[model samples]
Target: MVQEIRWGIVGLGSIAHTFAKDLALVTGGTLTAVASRSLEKAKAFAGEYGVAHTFDTYDALFESKEVDVVYIATPHTSHEALSIRAMENGKHVLCEKPMGVNPDQVARMIAVAEKNKVFLMEALWSRFNPSIRKAKQLVESGEIGSVGFVHADFAFYALNRDPDNRLLNPDLAGGSLLDIGIYPIFLSYLLLGMPKNIQASSHLYKTGVEMQTSMIFDYEGAQAILYSGLNSKSEMKAEISGSEGSIFLSPRWHEAQGYSIEKEGELVDYNLPTKGKGYTYEIEEVHSCLASGKVQSSMWSHRNSVDLARLLYEVRQKSNIIFPFEQQKEGV
Candidate 1:
């Protein structure tokens, strides 16, 4: 068994930095290498993290014999290509959420992983969060008494950011749907499973990027109301209601530190704080899977990622959401 798991991080962006910081907190993983299109960026990040190697290109990083796995933190559009290349080089991958731009892209990534016989998992950290996991247990134990409805929204005001930034740049697959919207959808799927039907609406900015989206997922006997936005800020809370009581997740619920359950007019809150931005939990999961020779995480498997991508693409279809590149490719 490979006792010490070596990690290489591609993309020296904010999320990558956060993940790298948490990787240090993991027991068996070491940040041995870093990579980016810019060597200076990679070197700077490596220096801060006490990393030993830096690669100017992802190909160099994936070809590294030292790195057992890699974390892909680049833009949404690059996830498929980067992950395919990494897996082809025999490096396990822990990709950032949404997995890909759509279900098709995600499927292709999975096929490559299978062909390479390497572990691959979407870094949907919320699925492994302590508080969220507890909530799942509570709900499954009938603490919530058969879920009837779910409500979650993740939003923030980012209109002032540069138009070219990822949040607003259509070229980078920018949109509220693929970014923050996936969280609410994931919560719904986690608790309620796939919906029987979906109703959605979206608002777009002048640059053709989706600014906000509203979704209604209909299950057999339950429903989920979800939203995501960048034009304005929201409470970022989440709620799940059942016949006997209601469960509430704190603001910024995706990374919620605590949650409450209300039964018969009495509300009880529970605190389950995360360790190191909550990415540590998923990092540990990847380590466990790799150590055991597993090709996917049981918690957030490839199937879950594909389903989430399908939900996203479905919402886009119903809401008439289309990106510039997609339109061009389709010759619209």
Candidate 2:
């Protein structure tokens, strides 16, 4: 019999709600506890998930022995501190994407994870996504011989969103680059590895946060054209083209349910539906790693996260995007 891995979630935001719902669809793991700054919010979330514990403060939950692992689902600005505290408290951590506001923060989080000797992973659900995985496998197997180009984009209109919203608020490190841009960037890195040279440009919102970013990642003989924006809706399609064929992840490709392969002038499609809201796959990955006594997932290692952070930070630097918290580090 497998022992159930106890799961706790911090931050009861919209994404957290989605994650909690998907957690129900996973097996060998149970939502043991939930924490929020507001006791009412914690209790409400706990009631919905049948979580055994609820804490008004994150520190309270971190202190509780009931939680074996904590999922940090808060905004990008809070990920570093929350995750470090959880690891320091002897709890494993699965933090949401982008992991931190900058490479420095991410390094701090990783250092704490290493020092604590606890499991830590950036919850990049797409890395564990079935369709994305198949596409990567096909590329690796030479189905897409000698990759030459990769293009992906994720965008949706949020310019109308109030300035106070995290999507536009510089205080929360809000922007298209860190929020949606990471998806396309992740795809580029997954298939193409690091770029030798890069070119990037970003359009800023009224709030001083970037609303749009376009990037060109240059590899040895390959290039990836990526774009993300909050000013308009994008096609949300992603394609990886090589000398022989191309792999097309369908619309809204980040969480694509299917993918197509075009080879020898023929296109073949494959359906690989996710179990629930896509978070279930990542939840299962966490379960597997914990069961195996692994500190990081092979699918998305800590090095991968660090590399991704560096890429993000570099892009921000090239595009002149800086969060309020990082301005001091920038000597501004």
Candidate 3:
């Protein structure tokens, strides 16, 4: 029998709480420890999750001999550093999406992971979503007959948030593109691959952060119209159209609970809801890869993460949406 994997969660925030709760439903995996900058916060999260270890410093958690993997759930700017440190400590890492602020940091993280021979995966939970999987299967099976266009958007109003909040803080890599824009980017990559040409526009807040971003991805035979925002709420549905038919994802498509395919004007519905915060699927994949001694995932490889980051970098460059950190980091 394969042994279970033990997890050490870095950054004890609300999202980490949700992740801890979901870990309860995963077999062969357990939340063994939690770390935060504050002892109080770490102890609180550990107590709530029934975790045995709680540390005030990330270094302690990363260096812990008990932890087999570390889930880097910190803010966007911190992801690269934390993942690299964990991997350097001989622990696998599942970092939250947009993996790094830019492609360069992502490249460095991948290199370190490869050098250390440790498993590393971006926490793009949407790829493993059942509805998304089903949609991909239909597309690959020729049910859609050569996709010509893909449209997806993820948006919600966040203008009321405080300037100090990560959503509005430029120093923290705060912006619609990194925060919510990644979902649309991921969908586009999944369907259209990397676009040969890219055009983008953004509406920046007075704080110099993007409030909304719209991107056009031009491929060999198809195009994708993607948008993400903190200015308005969208239907949040996704569509992939081809010569023969199209597939429509249910509302909140990124976390797809169901999807429908239309062919010759006939629509067929497929519903598959997930449990908890929808992280169990990726958790299972982590366990599977670990058991196989794989250093990266086939579904969300390090290269894929780097590609997505590079695309975002290009989009930001075109839209004049550079973050403050870009100036601090040379050659960003």
Predictions: Cα RMSD each: 1.1, 1.1, 1.2
- Give the C-alpha lDDT of model 3: 0.91
- List per-prediction Cα lDDT, in the order shown: 0.92, 0.92, 0.91
Query: What is the number of backbone collisions in each predicted candidate, taken in the order shown?
Result: 0, 0, 0
Task: Tell me the tens digit of each residue's lDDT in model 2 across 71-115.
Answer: 999999899999998999999999999898788888899899989
Worst 10 residues of 3 by lDDT: 323-332
Q: List pairs with backbone clashes in candidate 1.
A: none
TM-score of each: 0.98, 0.98, 0.98
lDDT of 1 by residue, 86-126 (tens): 99999999999878998889999999999999999998999
| Tens-digit lDDT string for candidate 3 (145-207) | 999999999999998989888999999999899989999998999877899999999999978
* Model 1 local distance difference test score: 0.92
TM-score of 3: 0.98
